[model samples]
Target: MKKYKGYLIDLDGTMYKGTERIEEAGHFVDYLVRNEIPYLFVTNNSSQTPKQVAKKLNEFQIQASEDRVFTTSQATANYIAQKKDQATVYMIGEEGLREAIQTSGHHLVDENPDFVVVGIDRDISYEKYAKACIAVRNGAAFISTNADIAIPTERGLLPGNGALTSVIAVSTNTAPVFIGKPEKIIVEQALEVLGVAKEDTLMVGDNYDTDIMAGMNCGIDTLLVHTGVTTKELLKQYNSQPTYTIDSLSDYLKHIN
Candidate 1:
């Protein structure tokens, strides 16, 4: 087993399922803390801010801090800022996505804008979708926080940001530039934040498609734990495999120092 200098972890299924926490996840984080290994929780959830996400983790008895969390909303804002400075944006999402765009010095407008940013908006309305479609049709660059179609919840799998993002994309016949997992954009940004080389960093999560593929897309090692969406049987269908697979996060503690 190779020692990793830094880690990019997933939040939902990897750490907890909806409102429930995975017990082994706390131990895994403890190992990282005790060894002084650098780590960041990378998530596709765009509804909550970093502080809120950390609070949720703390509730699970998992050690986490706001500074140690990176969200797709942050990635989307950073990506847009890099492309154009202080660009005008028309966004449809919750507080986290709104905060990221505002904090990045981007102007949020009602009508025509430079960009049409979409994330998970639980309060999604027909008017919100209409405005987003109008913005994109008017030539604004379309961007989505993530392409995840469904999210696991206590209720069951529900619509995610990707599902919400599709309204504008299908309406305007424009493909959105997705910024989260399975795309190299978020992982690349995360690596820069972690200040670690790709070869020395590990991406850990339970989902094979988003988490493992994100690492593979960015040339980083990946570990797949079977506590979430993808099962051992489901993973066997994929031709490409993660660098390591474990029954739980506790199984991975032995690989690290």
Candidate 2:
């Protein structure tokens, strides 16, 4: 097994399922803490801030902190900040996305903005879509946090941010730059935040399409745990495989050093 100095872990399914705790995940994290291996919990959910994410993890009995969480919202903000300083943004999302854009020193406006960013907004309205589409057509740069078509739930698969983002794209005939998993944009930025070389980081998650692919897209090693979205049987459908596959996070303890 390859040794890694840092780890990028997925939240939802990999760490816990909704409000429930994943027992093995706690132990795996504890091992990393004992050895001082750097790790960050990365998520595509742009509805919550890093501190909110950390609080949820704590409720699940997982060891995590605010700075140890990275959201696509942050990546989107960082991406925009890099492109132009003090750019004006027209947004379609909730608190997390709004906070990230503002904290990164960008302005949020309803019209004539430089960029239009779409994230998961549970209370989306036709008016919001109309304004975003109009702004994009009027020459605003378009960006989406992730292109995940669906979000998994106990109820079933529901539309994700990408699905929500398509309305504006189809209306304006423009594609938004996606900055989350399965894209190198977010991963590259995350490596800088984790302060670890890409070659020395390992991406760990339960989903093959997002987590594993994110690592592969960035030339980082990946470990796919079978506790989440991708099962052992389902994972074989992909051409590229994760560097390692384990049934649970506990199964990975032996290799942590």
Candidate 3:
């Protein structure tokens, strides 16, 4: 067995589904603590803040601090901060997205913004879409967090960021510049925060399209847990495969030592 010094983990599927946490998810944190390995929960969900994510992890019996959670919201903030010099942004997302952009020293506006940033905003209305479209049409750079089509919920699967992004995509006749998983930006940010090289970091997630593919793209080892969106049957269909596959995180941890 190879020893890993750092981990970039997904939250919704890999650690918990809705309000329920997977058995080995907490145990894996314990193992990391005992062995002194650095770990962070990296999520593509830009709806919630880091504090909200940390609280959710606590409910699942995993002790997580605010700093341990890295969301696409943060990544978007970093992207804007690095590129722009105080620009106004039109936001079509949640409070997390608003906070992230504002905290990065950028202004959030309703009209004539320098950029249009979209995320998962459940209360999104037609007017919001109209505004976003108008802004982008007027030359605002369109930036979106992730393209996840569906989000798993306690009720069932709900519309995700991709669905909203699709509307904007059609309106502007331009694709959004993505900064989440499957793109190198999020994974690269995770590696920088974890301070580990790609070879020594392991990415554990349940989504084949985003999580696993993102890890594979970044040159890190990926483990696919079948408990999420991707199933064993789907693996055969994907051209990109994970380095390892497990029925669940519980089964994967059994071989950790």
Candidate 4:
């Protein structure tokens, strides 16, 4: 068995879906604890704060703390802090985005200033889209946390951040500077938070486009678990590859011993 000293793990599709926890996701954390491996729950979902994520994980019986998770919302906030004017942002998403910007020491306003940060908002409406479009047209820089077009739920796949991003793209004739997975910044931050070097780290996820690609982009070995968005059949169809593939997190432990 290949042993890793640390991990950068995806949360939504890799660990759980919506409010549903994956089988053995709690056990996987126990495995890490027993092995004394450092791991960070890294997520591109900028819709929730670290505390909120921790609460959700805890509700699922997973031992997660705010310090153990890193999110794109925090990254976006940090990115905006270094901008030219510390731009006042018109946010079109969840409270998590607004809270992150405020926590980063940047001002967030509804009416016109500098930029518009968009993330996954469950309450997405046409008015929200129109406001974001207007803000972007008026020269506010458009920033998207991630480009995930759809999110898998027990009911079905639902529109994700990318859908809203596309609207802004067409309306403003501008593309957003995405800060989430498939991009290097979020992964880098995750590594820094876990204090792990790339060689000693493994990334476990279920998506090829975001999770797997993010790990590969940062030179970390990727594990694709077939418990969420992607499946073995889909991998074969797309010719997508992962360093390791397991039917599920439960089956993954069979090789651990």
Candidate 5:
């Protein structure tokens, strides 16, 4: 196996499932820290900030610092900033997404927005949908954090950002640029944050569709651990598999030298 200089890891499935913690996941992060290997918990979750994510990891007994966490929200803001400076945006999401946009020097407006961005908003309403649709129809740039149709939860499957992002897409018949997993945009931004070369970094996660595909799309190696989402059986259906696969993060511990 190739030695990866840095790692970009997934959060929800790979680290823990909702409020429950993953045992091997904690030790895996411990190994990274001990070896002085750089890694970032790259997440599609746009509801929480870096500090919030790190706190959650700490609760799980995983060692994490704020700088070691990166979210799709930050990627979205960075993307918007790169495209245009101080652009006016109409955003639909939680505190994390709002903070990212505003702190990036973008103006949050209700009318004639230069961009219309959507992330996961559990408290979604019809009015928010209408505004998003109106903004997109007004020739505003549309962006979605992730294309995940569903998110796995302790209760069962729940609607993800993509499902919520559909309203604007269907109404305006305009597709939003997705910045999360399975898209190269988020991975590129994560790599930039990690300060590592694509070839020398490994994308680590449990989901085959989003996490694995994101690495493949970004020309980076990926290691899929069966601690969450994709089971070994389901992974075989994919034509292109991840660079590496293991039953758990514990199985990968020996290879990290």
Candidate 6:
């Protein structure tokens, strides 16, 4: 097996399933830590900050730190910053998204903004949607954190940020530039943060559509573990495949050893 110098790992389904811990995942992370393998937990979740994410991973007994977590919120903020310095943004999301934008030296406003960025906002209301629509129609560039239509939870699949973003897109008849997985934007930013070349980095996740595609889009190898969204049978139906496939992280651990 070819060894990878660095890894970009997915969070939700790849690390833990909602509130439950994935035991094998902890072991895999432990192996990475023991070997001092460079890795970053790349997540599409825009609601929680890196500190909160690290806290959640520690609860699962997985070794993680704020510096090792990369979120879509951060990617969105970085994207906006690169496009225009200190651009004014009209955002619809939670604390993480808000903090990312403000910390990146961008201004957040309610009216006549330079950009309208959308993420998962559980507290979404008609007024928020109305304002977003107005801003987009009035010439603000539309951007969404991810295109994930549904999120898995203990209650089952619920509407994700993509679904929420659709409200503004449909209302204003405008298409949004999605920054999260299945798109190259987030992965490209993550590579820069990880400081690893694409040829030497591996993207690992349980979702084929988002995680695997993100790697492929950015010319990185991918590893798909059948512990979450995609099943063995389901993955077989896809024309493209991950560079590596394992039943669990434990299986991959054996190969590294």
lDDT of 4 by residue, 1-257 (tens): 58788988888767777778776888998788778789898888888889999899898888888988888988788777767446688887797787888887778787785888899988888888888888888988888988888877788888989886898898778989998998877787678778988888888998887888888887889999887778777788655477898877777677877
How high is the CA lDDT of each candidate model? 0.93, 0.92, 0.87, 0.83, 0.92, 0.94
Model 3 is weakest, by summed lDDT over 10 consecutive residues, at 248-257
**lDDT tens digits by residue: candidate 1, 17-92:** 7778799999999989999999999999888999999999999999999989999999999999999999999999
lDDT of 3: 0.87
TM-score of each: 0.97, 0.97, 0.93, 0.87, 0.97, 0.97
Query: In model 2, which runs have C-alpha deviations exceeding 4 angstroms?
Result: none
lDDT of 1 at 218: 93
lDDT for model 2, on a 0 to 1 scale? 0.92
Off by over 4 Å in 3: none
Which ten-residue region of model 6 has the weakest summed lDDT?
11-20
Candidate 1, pairs of clashing residues: none
Residues 213-255, model 5: lDDT tens digits = 9999999999999888899999989899899999888889877
- Comparing candidate 1 with candidate 5, which one achieves the higher lDDT? 1
lDDT of 6 by residue, 1-257 (tens): 68898999998788997788999999999988888988999999999999999999999999999999999999999999999999999999999999999999999999999999999999999999999999999999999999999987778889999999988988899999999998999999999999989899999999999999999999999999998889999998999999999999999989977
Please give the lDDT score at residue 63 for candidate 3.
66
Error of 3 at 169 (Å): 1.2
C-alpha RMSD in Å of predicted model 1 compared with the true structure: 1.1
Query: With candidate 2 superimposed using the best TM-score fit, by how many Å does residue 166's alpha carbon deviate from the native?
Result: 0.7
Pairs with backbone N, CA or C atoms under 3 Å apart (clashes), candidate 3 = none
